[model samples]
Target: MKTIKKLSLLSLMSLSGLGLAQYTPQWTEAPQQIDLVDMTSFKSISQPVNSEQQAVRFHYSLLGSDQLSDNNQGYLAESKQYWLNTNAQKLSQGLQLPVTSDLAVIRINPLNPTKSSQSLNQQDITVQQFDQTLSVDVFADSEQLKATGMPVSDYTVAFNVHTQPGMLTLSMPTATKALAKGDTFIIHVFEPNSEYVLQLKTSQQQYAANQVVKINSQLLSQSGVNHMTIAGYITQPNGEKLTDLSFQQNKNGDYQATIGQLTGQSLAHGLWEVHTIASSDINGLKVMRDVSTAFALSLPTARINQQLAVQSHGLKLGLDVAAAGRYEVSAVLSGINAQGEKQPIAMLMSAAQLNKGQADLTLDLPQDLIRQSGFKGPFVVDHISLKNQSLMVPVQQLSAGIQLMPLGKPMDQDDLR
Candidate 1:
């Protein structure tokens, strides 16, 4: 009767999940967020030093500037490179330059000219706004004159213009001269005592739909300013303004803004931008600067269930999916080796489309791998992670490891499944 009872107990145990030990997944606290874009970047135009006579250089590498500069000419020749830097704008035909003072000095540097050193004279060179001709002076560029292959016409020409309060259009007649395939032009607009640097930053580049975003902007100057203000707004992926950002100066002397609890309500899932403008009154002159930073936003759509099972075939875990999406789970099978030291045996990954609700995913443990690891009784599942392939976002991770009991040997080829 005792033997019969023992046989009955064995049968009950065998009829169960047919695995070894059950384990509860131990997940890490607050998994590190993913980064889909650059976290921190800086862009600033340096002050030209001598403020009274400083000129903001607007340089353009037109047509073939890169090729003619190198012996491998035409190999890399491309169309004109427009000026996209701060404080300068490239118009349809010429440049739209800003003037901050009544008196300004302008310099034009022609590069890779087709004429001889003396063929193109400065008397023929002229600059006009609408229809008025401005007086100009010819000055040989010591740097270009020292250059081996540069023509004299390609040297620097300087001009002093009087009176200006707003934007200035510096244009050359369409019949002045045609540029060579490799030629370029330069325009230097002098804005005296108008250089102030501003830098913008964000805490991270990628944020979940429910996470808050933090931003900071810093302004630097030579002396000090009387009044300074900074403000910004958010632009959605569709190029529509979402909300306004109000920045307050903190104790650390940096302007900071706490974005939001990005929560609820369907959001446009893509790259979002933060555009800011900072203005200051320096020595009675109003200076303003604009800057922008971009970051990626994603939705959390899946999660790994804490209740996991250990079976002879492998490890089985449940997923509590919030949305229907292609989800993936991966883990490292680790166990004690012959030396009584724990080590990784095999890496396993499984992915499938899981609808919202409870779904079972299996991390098949190969019999050969288990046999090779030589674990005596119990094993472990380390570095387990669940990710949404459809949305390409990592939803959950368990780094503390799940303690699993040693799996029983496969019963045959059929058990390998």
Candidate 2:
């Protein structure tokens, strides 16, 4: 009887309505967020006079993955980096240290970039575990700092806080000072490449494998931006740069780029790194902001309704996929208690009609289903599955600093009858 029960349990978790994972309802995607560490006045500590270590704290957010995986994956990990330097090197290079780990390649890995022959003040450092917050212990000789004219001269030390592979939570070029004294002096804080905060947005988080994805950019801080251009390449899981992509400001200062196989370009389904280079003219002073965000390229792309009100016969929606086949809409509720195998319950499926690769979809989500499943919070209209294709939306809400990675597949049959 015990063996039979175990078999039943495994079989129950294998349910795949609309080609979704058995644990679709068990997952939730939150909009990624970031916290920038202000190194300008964050802290000032003299290098330990006798090689004593001082710890500095860094706080952050949005390092967790939204998709469901059987493996226990997390954003935090051990890092041997977290530099405190005066060379004024770029933080983006620090971003690549985890993958490259080439101290020689980074160039700034040396204790002193000025090629000073003194090892006394050549910073001794220890990197610890990274979470939403982290601490680094830096040891510097006071005499060595004074020898280098530090606190009296106001030399700035920088840190590159790597949150994840492509996502950076906080990076302050001059976030802290290893040596600080009561006397005020020349504070050597290098200006950031670009003071403008640019955010990349898409119509939806997920897309079809061969879909022509739309790119939307917003200058959160629009000051000092006379003109700007966006340039970069997308890196595939295979360590390949898909192509050199770029975009410039239009007549209305609108900048955009369309990339995919549909436009004589190549974009496949997998995790991708989008490295962006923005050169903007601030008061005629051209500055550059080089950063990157990540998302997944998928198949059966569609538009998701973020703020939908409950209707009598479910909510009507639209999709940006080929409008040729019958589509099935599915959903999973959020903020509810998991009781038995019924928590992530699949609602009654609804059929969708299409016109020219567009969907006027209304999934049959009745009040009975909501009450039965104990769905107290919002519902994630997760994905759309059809006879020939399916699309997965990794996130339900579009918030600031969020990175999207949606997935899709072709050849689908109803997992739930």
Candidate 3:
């Protein structure tokens, strides 16, 4: 009974068209709500440090959103008008960062009564420091408070803060790197989000085999930008343009580099690869970017030539033979000319039986056939077949005195004088 049950289980396992497995959700995070205050700033580190580090300031304003203001009541309705100013003195002392001489205005609406008291008269403050840590100060205008609402009613205004780091660098192995003769290599890049750019550069020699590289990129934020570009040089050993190399990106954001058939008589010995991506600067002038690495090339293999000859006769006409291998020979007897001309001649012999390097053949050329046909010159042979395979050889003209000799036999003579 166990044996029978095992056999039935195997039979069921061999059946096809089983139902597909269930798919699980790939994304789990909730979408972010749009912010009311859009803040953008540029910050950089000062070089050749002095006692006072370069001061960095932040400037921002409240953006009026028809969607956010829609259906607003009480305190929210009166806060949409007028430019909100920051308490820079209090913010500067609290954050311990320098305050710029200029005061930036934060715009707000006052007619909308639904505005919240917390969102009234807001201050936009920017802080500068040499250390990695920094803070932003937000304030609301008290004058924009609604008269009829609860004195302490709550209203929320979303703020988006973006920080741009300076002078970032990234490196990875490039596609142009040579693989060990029979092996393969994958070229790729590591990026935090779609807001970054990747650049790759390579030399001319590496462009020959560009099909082996792969790329993958993903966008993290819905508001982030995606961009890619692939470009490189095709220079010879002496630094000349053998060709131009270009690249294209696929749906997955991988750049495919391509170069047309290489031209120029001279060969190239050295190759280089390079690629670059310039991403959009969401917050400041210093955009996130990355570049693919470069690689050197190895030398190519040499070519080989093969040739053969037999018994000093040059093996002409119906007797032509070719060496297919170290010890294998094939016989060819007939063929057409290049000008579409046909040269038909009588077959004096055919290699009917062959063993090792030797063959037994039969000849049927009679004097009457040759004379009646008035076919002058050596008997021309075009092609020969053996073991279901055939080949053609160059036409060979034979002497009129030449006669067919039997296999493994000496020549017979009409006259030996």
Best candidate according to lDDT: 1
lDDT of 3 by residue, 2-63 (tens): 98767666654432111011111111122111111111110111111122222221112111
Q: Which residue ranges in model 3 land beyond 4 Å of their true spot?
A: 1-225, 229-232, 239-245, 263-270, 275-277, 282-301, 304-417
Clash totals for all candidate models: 2, 7, 58
lDDT of 3 at 56: 22
RMSD of 3: 34.1
* lDDT by residue (tens digit), candidate 2, 1-417: 898667665554442222222111212343222121222331231111122122211112211213322221111111111222332223311222221111111112223222232221213222222343333223333343467665522222323322222222223223123222121111121123223455555454444444575554534344422456667677764466878766656565556666875211112244566666555555444334445555554323233432233334344444544323333444332223453221333423454434444445555444444444453433444433322121222212222111111233322223222
**Residue pairs that clash (backbone atoms under 3 angstroms), model 2:** 39-175, 207-298, 208-298, 208-299, 209-298, 209-299, 323-357
The global C-alpha lDDT for each of the candidates, from Candidate 1 onward, is: 0.53, 0.35, 0.27
Cα miss at 276, model 3 (Å)? 4.1
After TM-score superposition, the amount by which residue 77's alpha carbon in candidate 2 deviates from its true location, in angstroms, is: 22
Model 1 ranges off by over 4 Å: 1-25, 28-198, 220-228, 261-269, 280-289, 310-317, 329-350, 360-387, 391-417
lDDT of 3 at 30: 20
Every model's TM-score: 0.43, 0.34, 0.21
lDDT of 1 by residue, 42-103 (tens): 01111111123221111121111121111111111111111222111221255555454565
Best candidate according to TM-score: 1
User: Which of 2 and 3 is ahead in TM-score?
Assistant: 2
Model 2: lDDT equals 0.35
